[model samples]
Target: MTTTPAPTPDSTVAEWDHVVVGGGSAGALVAARLAARDSGTVLLLEAGPDQPVPRDRAHPLADAGRLVLAGFNWDYRANLRSSGRLEDLLKGGDGTGNPARALWERFPYQLGKVVGGGSAVNGAIALRGLPRDFAAWAEQGNPDWSWDKVLPFYKAIENDVDHPDHPRHGDGGPLPIRRTPRDRVHALDAAFWGECTRQGVTDLPDLNSGEEAGVGPIPGNTVEGERIDAATAFLSDARDLPHLHVRPGVRVTRVLFDPKDRSRAVGVETERDGRLDTVRARHVILAAGAVGTPVVLQRSGVGDAALLGALGIDPVVDLPGVGRDLVDHPSVVIWSRPADGVCTPGLPWRQVAARMSSGFDDDVDVQMGLLNNVESHTIPGFVDRLGWPLVVGMSVMLLRPRSRGRVFLDSADPLASPVIELGLGTDPEDVERLCHGVRRAWGFLRSPGLSARLTRTQFWSDRMVANDGVLRSGVRHIMNPGWHAAGSCRMGPDSDPYAVADQEGRVHGTENLRIADASLFPVIPSAPTNLTTLMLAEKLARSMKE
Candidate 1:
């Protein structure tokens, strides 16, 4: 276990009007807004280092890799459980070798432990939820969370490139949204869009207009040629606020509640500098992402009584849904070499035009620029060298997956990694849908524009493409998660017995305690989750002000 420095006398006992538990995407936004609202003092506590961009992880694109290698990111692991006997599987048993299965069985769900949390090291894709998504929330019992009510908040945080005249989009919102310029688009990306149009798919000019059915270039969280990570956008400038206090490197052990009331979360107990210190707060908001939030809840005695008792924890709240209903987008990559000279795979004109015309099929919801050079460190031995580059590839992700997973306590020890039960593809439809997505990718590659510039590579090995079963397996092998975890502390009406918070992000049964992060998302939207998360934070801030 990594030890944090002891809190000095000046830091140990301080009172605040609102205490924000995280400094990442949602937490930062909430803190900034709360402070700006003239709400009394607010304290932001982060478990990672104080530095914005740690020295070890210098490059912006390489931060994810650094977090994975170093233990800066929450390296959550899990045990595998069979979909056939999920209950029995949870009881502890051997797991199948499927990556998702292994995720449930062997590895703990990893979350970034730094100040910016996962936002500092994410693929910066910014997408808003579809109208149908919010309507579905109302249908599911969250009436106040309908699209009509939420659209204003969504618009309040976004500044779209195409529609500058819209009054809804705020020019001064902390989050930045911009179109990927044509000069930056790769040649293969242009071909992909061209093929989609040729196939007769309707092109969507803007996916963020709350209509997310068609295809277009994925919008990113970038501004002024630099990635606007949550830490940089929300926390850096606001740090000087006299009302805001930020404590880095402090690991919150558990939330402290009044034993008599049980509903009131009075404060939090944390270990700093090898010593235990308790800080009191009238309001406590948990923004520890899907994995960390539940863990904190369970540790603080707010979960299934039986499970808590088994782990020797006294139950404060018997919320069975504390660690259930997890969802994530799984993706696969298709690689091809272009016959022409190296594709200038940055933001380019051909790529922008293609993105503008990319909606050819209903199946492919969002299309990102597939670069010629693979710059990911997750894939072993593949590096993007400006010269002598021979391989090019595009990653195709399933926009909406039917798979559901969970995060649970592996042991009573709060320090041990939690057990993540990712039941991916257990639903036969999920597997079939992914297979269909791969076929769609094949169609896009065969488009005249792309085909004119590229040569085909084997699906896995040259021999595997001929066999349908092999092709399916290859797709599965190449696919990995795009992160974007949500739904652990889901928000909704009382009908959802497991939901931890209400529409305003206020934790159920608690007066001042609320959850202001991704953990409150009841359903993972069809688009990328980062922007939606920021929107939620903005909405939460407004609700708090009112």
Candidate 2:
């Protein structure tokens, strides 16, 4: 896809009605919709290169096998070690019996640097957050985000090919949603589902149709093996709009304010090709993802006054919650050896998954994905020594975690990546719930159907699963982020002390400035956040026009 070149540095005096920072999933759609409505001239800026999206051949963004392609990611690292208990558990003395410190060290965070953000690089699972998930947001002072109110926006973002007629699924929208046919389901995934069924896990044909608890083929935003992400969905046609300008490789540093009126945002300062420039706008919207948005806000002096003061930044807005309350699904995976001939040709890597409530009385709080392969250095060397083409892994994720973390600036420089400390296992309940999920996954691996197709013994030894203390240790050791980060710039009412943005996405203390991305989530969703991020943009863009 082609876009207009960015305006020259001196062109900062040329005013745009709306300037959007970050050409990610949310920002791309927001700019497209606003421009389409003739509301204003919209300028979308991205720090990464405008990657070539070719329909004729396979591309990394288009192929699930090349999910995390090199050179297209922001390459952020997160410190997951949060508590003293965790430190004690992971600390090694003389390096004798305990797993190496590297195993429990920092995790690599995958934030998309390209135009489509995560939608360009993610696994493309088109699942929605549970209705209860939105209800909780409403309860947190964002009544506009209630499930009933946001359902229309969700419908407006997708054209579901598999269940277009279903009341909950949409038929006409920019993105296409489809699921793998039962006959074409990967052999390993099919076995997983069968095992789940025997253990009373519901056999769900459609996981996104009102009911979320069950095992089924995942609905993805893929058509004919190519990705139709936000850029491909919204900006592809909107690029023709004379008012819309999607400029890649322009890195926005901070929102600019009127000199006299500190509360009013007038524009933003950006860096491109080692040249610093300013771009004036009547309104500035921050759709940078959870990590990028908070970094921009804090850098612009919109975070805790004390923190900003320490960094020598004059405070623009003293919103202490700007980078607080970071949330994500804590996850772990158990690798198993596949039986002979199980890794057949044409078998998909990950096409089926399960969401279970497990021991919890609440909504489905646990997610399980069947992975045919995972070539990560994080895994044990013994597994790699087996010499199989791919090792089977059952990943379990805690959907609703009570633990919270932070995203803060390591330096005032816009080019510097922020320090992300995911306080995983900070809350004992999170660890306890994850342990329960792990035990359930262990049972699934041992079930007749899966055992017949793979070795019952997993990389996480039977001895570890047998002892409660050992199981808890294993849970802490193997836990990883779900790659669904949110709540860094949460939305809520003025009454909420931690609310950075109100229900309309307006930054609490700044005029003509708003945020539309995963950062606006008061709480992280139970499912993959890509679809929800698009829905948020569709809703926020319309609200901005009104």
Candidate 3:
């Protein structure tokens, strides 16, 4: 056992029934649910900007027309490309540095730093993974988390405007949902889907409703064009609750444990306005997300003991799983030019998605979609060549990537960004899977529908797409670490070596300490994690009530 010092709080004024460490998707729900019960006080802390993103019509970035470059996003100028193949390729007189690679080459990890976190800036493509995703989680010793068990929570939080009458949906929920109109869909996207249909892929009406494996317009969480972020959806009503207090612009440095028993976490040490303070609570819910949560745990000496000892902090729980098993979709993009006369449509076009199998097996592991807001300025030396207002592109993500990475401390400073290694394309199969998706994307552009509206054709380069080996190499060269991430503090049964928390969201070896965020997910979901993260909060809220 190592000796650790319990944090000395300046005052007890920050005490509450529950203290939530983030103001993102999961954190918002934690404060909202606990404060709604009229039993105890709740306090939420967000290290980012205090004010919410204005949903006013004048806010252009927040408009439905373009990608949200909200001020609250944290650009961790960190590199995600584990393999330096892309840089070497470019250095060797390569002119085609595609936007996906060039733009994200140095600064890859774009994380939400505002009250609602990712929901404030994401494309709002709310979706859930296949039933197999949750079943896999259950198989990893996390029981009661199968799709059937978690479906009710998904229903409880979503207010699907298009599917109010649908059996699996809820009537009145916090987040508003609207399916992108098929007629309003971008012409290129419509044609791409049309081509997919001609090729025998079925039409999935709603992937969020758990029906997967087809092409359809995705649902965005919006009400009258304004994003319905986690802060606006759940934390709105909680603000009126007298017992709830949300403190923004405060960063949590480390978890505070009870002096008598270090195994019991009771509060946290925080930094705000250049001052250190303490916030005590009966129960502490770390909702700082996958990247953020592990940093807190490791700083508090909750990770591997040897690592903590090196940093002059004693271990609270010798769980080596705190920063292990980091997972995310290793993705790539394919850019194409539209036929000369077709003026670009204005709306952000991450509006639809297609799920298909990458290999010979029938199971769906690849997700292909048409993105409209392709930033061509970041394209290679030939940016002057592909001249258009907005470019059309095909982006692909491997749903079940076998490649796993890690998250760990940089210098034991909570303010420091966690060093994230997105071990993408390390697995040979992942490279092949992405290559398959690329081939499919090439096919889509060459199809009769898109072919008529696009330039004869173009790959990142002629050499890149020449053959299978080169294609896979090109994939490794331009792989994106993915915008979303998960699995830093994975939850599982005690018997598992990487089990940081148990099924109930309770961190192992600690009392009154639980995790309620994407950090608890053992693996990244097949779908965008926004909806699933909310579902996790709903389920955890219900579990606490029980």
Candidate 4:
């Protein structure tokens, strides 16, 4: 890849055919595709500095499970108070029946600030969200986003090593997808799967097949132990293209509008090294992620008219949905000590996960997966918090939570962090289902196969399960982000007042503006959103070319 210095903010206004913001998962791929197709001169801007992907075991990013690393993460925090009624119970207001004191406060929200975005640092699970996920998008008046229509994009974006010849899988795509071999799978994972079978959870070979839901090998995007993120997969070949300019450490402050025709977007205003400058572009695509994208739009005077006006910003578009309907996978973990022979540093971070329906007829709503080792397991200070040198974990996640939250601007400053409120467990059903998942997990842990491989040093006492109220309190204190955020900027027809953009990712109220990111999801998918985000970039890039 070519190394080109970012243009100085004080220099003459740089112009390009398209200016894509945020070089994370989607932006990198979009810019690469446009440039490789020779669409036009494209300028890609990223707020974080670029770093090479390191494969050595000594590096922080070497293990996909090492997600809590400090330097390269956005480190956004969210208010996870599900409701006010549970506040007292969470705070230990009741005299009894609370397992862990409730921490109903702002919790950490992880997003990659690096070039490859989350794909660079996240657990590399390559999941194609259930087909019904797209069907729901189509139901929301986005016909082009239907499962049948979007399946082609999904197929064309992956090079599945295990299922290359399968009709539904792709063999020539840039991103690589593979699973850990059965024989090489960790003992803990094998035991977990054995427990899954006893629980009547089917063992499917491919989780992404969309045929059946059960325990299966995790499909990850990795090559020789190194993550194949968007930057490595999409930008490697397109970086040398004379037309594409990748400008790291340059953050786009807001989208610029035509002075005369305020409804038309012209380009963007950017900030880098404390200097501010404007860049001209024929079109501006907001690939700034769900949180970043909505913040950008709000800063640019394109959110709820009242909210913008209260912040003394002129309203460019009166779309009230810019930062509403925020959704993320809310999860809680049950930690235990691994068997004497387990927790080997050589073992893969994750191997098997159970995807099953909590109650839905056709949809898989929950995910229970094993983390072979906790984040920063190799570090002493970090491991001290969990009180274990090395601990295995089973994360119970609500894949399709009914609760919805938001990311909104508390300050008009472009660089100011937005307020993130994750309304997790706001829906009573959410809490109930999570409690159910925890019970199932407890059963698995107590099963003969898993019991032999895991120690009884548990994060929470097994007796807590008998008390529903106490179990709910435990859910409140321990529930956290699954690191998958979406739906802040939803796509729908104009008839739907909350719709910010159309099916093609075009902003409805403005001209020459578009969005290509997870922010466009109408509903959070029933799986990790990494692969689906890449599929989105591939489809949007092709549409832009056409």
10 residues in a row with least lDDT, candidate 2: 89-98
Clashing pairs in 3: 339-453
Tens-place lDDT per residue, model 4, 82-126, is 333223323434312223423443466768988889888888889
Clashes per model (N, Cα, C within 3 A): 33, 0, 1, 0
**What residue runs in model 4 are displaced by over 4 Å at the alpha carbon?**
1-14, 53-59, 82-105, 359-363, 375-386
Q: Put down candidate 3 lDDT per residue, 18-131, tens digits, no spaces.
A: 788999899988789987875477778998875543345565325554445546777665445443332333254232334454433365467888888877767677787678
Residue pair clashes in candidate 4: none
Superior by TM-score: candidate 1 or candidate 2: 2
lDDT tens readout by residue for model 2, 10-104: 34437888899999899999999998988867888999878674434456676654365467888777777542322232242221222443344
Poorly placed runs, candidate 1 (over 4 Å): 1-14, 53-72, 78-110, 337-372, 376-391, 455-458, 461-468
What TM-score should be assigned to candidate 2?
A: 0.91
lDDT score, candidate 3: 0.76
Q: lDDT at 217 for candidate 4?
A: 91
In order of appearance, the predictions have TM-scores of 0.85, 0.91, 0.89, 0.91
Query: Model 1 — which ten-residue stretch has the worst lDDT?
Result: 349-358
Error of 1 at 358 (Å): 14
